[model samples]
Target chain A: MNIAEALKRTFPMKDLSQGKAASIFASVKSKMPAFVLKNNAPYRAVMTMDDYEILEWAHEYRLTHPGVVWAESLKWESEEDKDDHIALFNRLEATKNSGSLGGKELLDAVQKLAAQQ
Target chain B: MAEVDGRILDAVGRFAELSFLRMKPEALLADLQCLFELYGDSFEEVMDGVVKALKDIAQDRVTVSPMKYDLSQYSCYHFQSVVEQGQPADMRSLFKRAEDGTLEVEMIGNRFFPADIYTRATERIEYYLGDIGNMSE
Candidate 1:
């Protein structure tokens, strides 16, 4: 089902801009339900809402336990050569070519990441 | 995937450090490069992955005040009706399952968060990747 329909089934919502709908879809993807509306019908994609809620709780759970996690160690690659720059550029370009996942999920992802220690 | 994973961990470390101290997003764009790289293909997939991983890390160790958005507060904004509430703590395969004529829904309603939450979050990701404070260490 498209996002609008899916969302409609879950919540009493009004028509949303594609951008806003897309953003909400991203935010809720983490252990939350998101929907797309197509021809006024709900289509399902991604995980189940129950599962998404679990993930959301997990994020909340992590906030209380900050000592168990460990951080990774990365040495700065001091490579500023043209090739390295080009590779970074290539990666950026590749990602752009695909498209961006904006919305609340993106924002949630940001919040969850910030909570890490 | 190995290169990407490595870079992701590196950046995650930086984000962790920044988050530990509640820093801002002045350097968020730079710090988020690690997350941006890992989430290279689909923004949704990568973001979902980030949420999962961050939650995992938080649960494993360290303790901080959690930033929460009340699902009840912004109930009006939701489009879905019945969100599949999973195990209270497990986040492995949670998703929005569509039923006969309904779907689960929740709105973005975190009140404690600031307007620049995303920017701040990116900085946290950078701090974790950079291995700045590392309180556990």
Candidate 2:
């Protein structure tokens, strides 16, 4: 199949112009994450209801841990780079080609985080 | 996960130091992260428990005071839900497992926590937040 046919079968990837013209969330469905592209790169993601609620629960739980029960230390090269845990995790998952997570550092940080678990 | 673990402790320790009405989202975020680490695949079961616990506590937790601390002294709301485990006077940590292998949880509150315990309270709070309300339904 051609590129248009391939895109239709795999995902209804919409461009930013389309996102502006219509409700970006109009086609969202459970287990299907809708993508919005800008300059042919991922610009935004819209999740279905079930996915959104899971994120909500995770947000609630993270805000209350450890002092009730846990603690530990981290020694990371990029530790000083990003203090935000979400950003830090993103960095950990990033490839060096994307300018982060230089292999060893991510492994060390994940190991440190997984030690007690 | 120990780093996540300690960061969470730091947040709750700070939360315990503050008034209940001033609950910090920072601390709550830490608790959620630690929960993800602890339960992994079965985290959903625990979330259901949390929903149940919160629904019950959210009902009548306002007017009455906890027996452990006077409102004038300590602000940690160690309600009957936390203490009636009857397990120990000092189950100081947050999570415990029930006989059926389900996870049990506790809140962070104390009458006399040391000032030295929460030295990281001054750390910048940059946690990103989104609407907690389910938009699907």
Candidate 3:
């Protein structure tokens, strides 16, 4: 909501002449979230994928978890590329009681075996 | 003496091989609504006004909003989910994607699942064979 600082870099509508507009885009497309102003008011804004994704995820996480404050939940919105936990889930899911082990004993056995390795 | 259920483990392994993930328009649009609302009062006056100005293209994009983000992660809560497919259970390696993409769910994820069922299944298998050091760690 405190976007006053963000509004520092703005392109007035009349300034968007063809040649200048192309160069302006080239200058800010990568580092965007630039505002386009017309009649002294912002009309449209340009945003990069990174900026957009962060805002998108943050908004979604905020709405889904109402109790979580914006800044606190923003930390959890970054995308992680690893899936080791899921792999572990698979290995654990693939279990079947072929021998004598069935409940907690089985979990303990796996834990012990995992520990030794 | 409280142990795991053998049937549950068997079912999980068998079901892991299947893939049925679908997204409906309602759920998809709701996600977008949440995003637009980030601007608060400006959502309707400023943002929505832009859409109104470019209503044709904007409306079309809004219709296919679900396709915009081909999600890599899926935390299934319903029988037929839509954002993306649920993860496939393949315990072959330690770092491969869930059949393709990474799916990192929370400790309590999905309604159909009783949370971490895969872990239980793997434990049962290990308990039976009393082995798997080479495969899992």
What tier of docking accuracy does candidate 2 attain?
incorrect
Each model's fraction of native contacts: 0.00, 0.03, 0.03
Runs in model 3 deviating more than 4 A are A1-8, A29-32, A70-117, B1-137
Return the lDDT, model 2, position A49: 80
- Model 2: residue B84 alpha-carbon error in angstroms: 16
Least accurate 10 contiguous residues by lDDT in model 2 chain A: A67-76
lDDT of 1 by residue, A1-117 (tens): 565655554522343453465555555644446554556566444456778677678666444322212111122234333243334333332223222122333334444433431
Worst 10 residues of 3 chain A by lDDT: A73-82
Better of 1 and 2 by lDDT: 2
Listed models, DockQ each: 0.02, 0.02, 0.02
What value of lDDT does candidate 1 attain over all alpha carbons? Answer: 0.34
Candidate 3's iRMSD? 17.5
lDDT of 1 by residue, B63-135 (tens): 2233233211111211111123541221121112123311111111111122133333332333333343342
Residue B24's lDDT in candidate 1: 22
Using all chains and alpha carbons, the TM-scores for the candidates as numbered come to 0.19, 0.24, 0.25
**Residue B102 shift from truth in candidate 2, angstroms:** 28
